[model samples]
Target: MKFNKLPLEEPVLKGVQDLGFLYPTPIQEQAIPSVLNHRDLLGLAETGTGKTAAFLIPILQFITNSPNNKVSGLVLVPTRELAQQVYQDAQALNKYCGLKIVSIYGGVGKFPQTKQLKSGVDLIIGCPGRILDHMRDKTLQIKDLKYLVLDEADTMCDMGFLPDVNKIISETPTSKQTLLFSATMPEPIRKLTKNILKDPVTIQLGNLTSAATVAHTAFPVPSGLKKDLLLHLLDKTPTGKVVIFTRTKYKAKQLARDLSKEDYKVTSLQGNLSQSQRTNAMNGFRKGKYDLLVATDIAAHGIDVSEVTHVINFDFPGTTDDYTHRVGRTGRAKQSGQAFSLITPEDKQLFNQTKKKLDIEIPLESFKDFDYGIFNPSTFNDPIKRNSQTQSGETKPKKPPHFYRKSAGNKYRKDVNGYRRSRSSSSGEKMKTHTSSNNYKRRVRPKSKSKV
Candidate 1:
């Protein structure tokens, strides 16, 4: 369906057309009407299904009809990569509508965001952490916020942002149109909606386990041999731009360095990167300055680069749903792509469970000359378990969510420093929500819901 016919304002319609959006994806076709109708929405969609545009089009329409030029619509995302992505899409779609959109997040200068707040912006897209920072400083004000959107709600909840998100919602007026979109409606997201939304219209895009366009595969290589397998596949596979998904920020950087060392164009995205550095990475990646991008789940949804030929999972993700989302980076928009994982013995169970969750058989691909026995538990260096007794005293990761110390030190202790388990890492336990970062929910009528 064309976006113009979805109860959008003339200017918003013009803007959508100007962006060359002639058709709507399955999620957009269902969610847009609900949003334009001002109904609270709960939606689920796969990545690269034009989800951002789904919500942004209606937001632009509502705002265009009553342009506040201030904080009228607010989009809350989980990471900086998503913040930029949502803001960039909103701006792109509303370029002809004269709406000011600002992306606010930390790990960079705050002055520019503060300045934008002062000057006034029609829509604001941001991560919960940085937005709270601005709010605390009294530099960013949203007294006039009308629409409150929680994109990737499951992720926010997983990142332990439920408390922080509650505080942010408290800051916004209760009499607001709330939209919560998640790939999976976890307990936290369900409860969050119960507190915030008023008779929300729920749209389930069916029980689709995985993206049909992506062909999944798991190569049962030993842990130590992951890099060699990745290199071999990259050299032989017919790939467009490729994305190498890792478990941690350190691993992402290390992989990028290793690949770059082999003269392969590469970059990485992680929380450790400053805003400018991240911008550089995304810009370079999108512009084809890099053939492979090593990233954590942070960029999984936000990245919408089309025709990604392959998705390489160097490490086993924590959840089966995450496995779906990670591999979803490719084979989008009806294009076929491959998802290959370098699984070790420890991941054998996970690999089995993941296939069950995806409800598809993942044919194993064996390496001709690669030896997996060395990278297996017997020969691979065993990781050490650190004694981080908390103040009752429990241990937690001192850094990123990926850093974790498994009790079975023999398997995970190789580089225990990064995962020297800390309490903070516990709070930031990764959630497995995967949806297109570009999605937006709009409505024209309220719909009924079914009980779970």
Candidate 2:
């Protein structure tokens, strides 16, 4: 229930207290002890359920008790963002312990990381690619690894790094403690577990691949008007940290730019930016430099900021798994949170799948007369039509066409010859034929008769 009763070291307890962690979430409550006891664990918990702390806390305590340079613990994450996050947490919590932690991920030089390895670190927190690089060069050794953690396992598999992960694991001692974590357990993950983890303790929270704490809602609107709806909601919402999830890095940048132009202090995270740009954005967000954070899903991993009151899904994520991770940004650490999705009519089916996956109904809320200000549904029915439909099964009468049109049955009025002629009721003018030439002939015949 509490951090103190979990058999953690006194130093870790002090750090946890300083960090204001009182009660453990479901995953933490179950997984911490297993990790502390040095048992292999396969934990299935949604993001933001304290999965990081579940593994990190114990590893820190263990390394604090005994430390070495042969990489005592190895954490394999799926993305650069997550690797940095784990490294930061380890560095922070293990500050007093004097345990060295190195973060190795792509987008930078191998020389620096190799140089860091030469200096000796007790732990290696890295992405699959960089870790594989070290293994290929025989520069890093994990044979002495006592703790091996696969964080966000499903993501790793999705990114097509399972072979790399397996190779990295093979380099380590088979007797090492393996901790595998995933948000969803697809069949591949299950098979990977069966082959890799040995008689592991299993812990799961919420429905599979879904966050139970997050309240989900979708506002059906046109894609073009999504920005307007986002602004309106931000203006109307209560003050707290907010994360806006965009589908692409370009969208993330554009969203941040537009929001900043609107005079709202905001930050952005994406793949294209350099490491410094990412660091600045993350630090700004964590230090309250900006209350609004716009990011792509890749940048969103390992962002464990607190007091995030809302998560706005500016683009409906591609899959239910992604939706779970996006919403998990909020409702963290037992705090209440709300996630709103701006869905187009095309995304309705995806929204419904999310609902079914999450096993909950999230009703759409309307601000009457506001039309939510920006979102216009493709199938938007008139309020009058809605009222009539409620009374009868049919929609209300259709108004006359806005453009002028003659009656449908008049071929003379609609065909090619009708353009120069007048109708029977149209000013009651007589019609003239283009081929008639009798006027000049009659005048000539009268002249001829006078001459005779």
Candidate 3:
């Protein structure tokens, strides 16, 4: 149905038309009605499916149509980036409505936020931590709160902000209408809905998996050669805006630097970066100033860059849910995109699990020029296959291996008697092997006359 057909105020409808949104997305079409009817709602939809607009439109409508406009609406998000994004969406949708909206998030100075809060905003979009800080400082009050939205509920749980979320919810009025949205409904989010929502209308659009428009491909390479494979793939693959996901902030920064050195327009979005740096990186990437954005899982959710052409997982995510969010960065808004992952032998278990859980076949691809034999799964210490000691019923920790100094040629020669000798130590100084139950270290004798 068209957005104008929905029960929305004239100002809200005008704002919708100003944004050129003619028809409602499936989630918006289904969930907006329940939300407008002043009932609690639980919406399950994947990224890039217009979930933000679904809640924002109705929230804005209620605020515009309300007789008393206190600080009635509050939206709790998981990340600073998401807070800003939703704030912008709210601004755009509240154009004709002229409702006062303020975005409160950490990573920036609080003076501006305090000023805005004191000035009396109609709605607030903020992260849980910053919102709690404001609540503690008594700068923002929500006792009379009417509409409360918990966007990306699963992400907040994953990021360990559930306690803060619950605290914030407890401070709000119990009679308020609550709306909870998530891509996947894990046990924590399920319990959350039961407690926060009151007979909510549940609207689930798709399966709890990655987007169907994304074509998944895995390139098996050695751990040490992941960077090489990434460079090669970037050179060969045609992409507009590419997002590369790494597991650590350090990896994101280092990879972004490496890509910059290779003359690729790149930036990094991770937790370690300063607030301004993070904002600049995200804004630059979104505006096409940078072709590649290397980020941690912080950017996995609530980032609404609809034109992303590709997503590369430099480090395979730790869980299937993380994998879904990483790949979901691309294939947004029904646009087809490619998701490439550099899979090491160590990721074999997670790789298998992801395919099985997502119920999709991710084709193993090999580059014609890159070598894939550098990492041998058989030789690699597979955690799945423990040592023989475990089979022998030995529970004690294994002894540390002895380390000897390298020879002049950096090679050790094995004699016929099973003894190892350095080529430079021809003076009959044979390398001795020692086994000890406790942690042990053997010092090599220096060439000097004094013993070390």
Encode model 3's per-residue lDDT on 235-281: one tens digit a residue.
66657788999999887988888887777889999998888888888
**Model 2: CA > 4 A from native:** 371-452
Of candidates 3 and 1, the better by TM-score? 3
lDDT (Cα, tens digit) per residue for candidate 1, span 248-346 = 998898778877767787899887887788889988999988878899986665777885777888898888767767876887776777787777756
Model number with the top TM-score? 3
Candidate 2 vs candidate 3: which has greater lDDT? 3
Model 1 residue runs over 4 Å out of place are 299-301, 369-452
* Candidate 3 clashing pairs, residues 3+ apart or interchain: none
Compared with the true structure, all predictions reach lDDT values of 0.73, 0.76, 0.80
Point out where model 3 deviates above 4 Å.
373-452
RMSD of each: 13.8, 20.0, 13.1
Q: In order, how many clashes per candidate?
A: 31, 0, 0
Give Cα distance to truth, residue 90, candidate 3, Å: 0.6
Which scores greater on lDDT, model 1 or model 3? 3
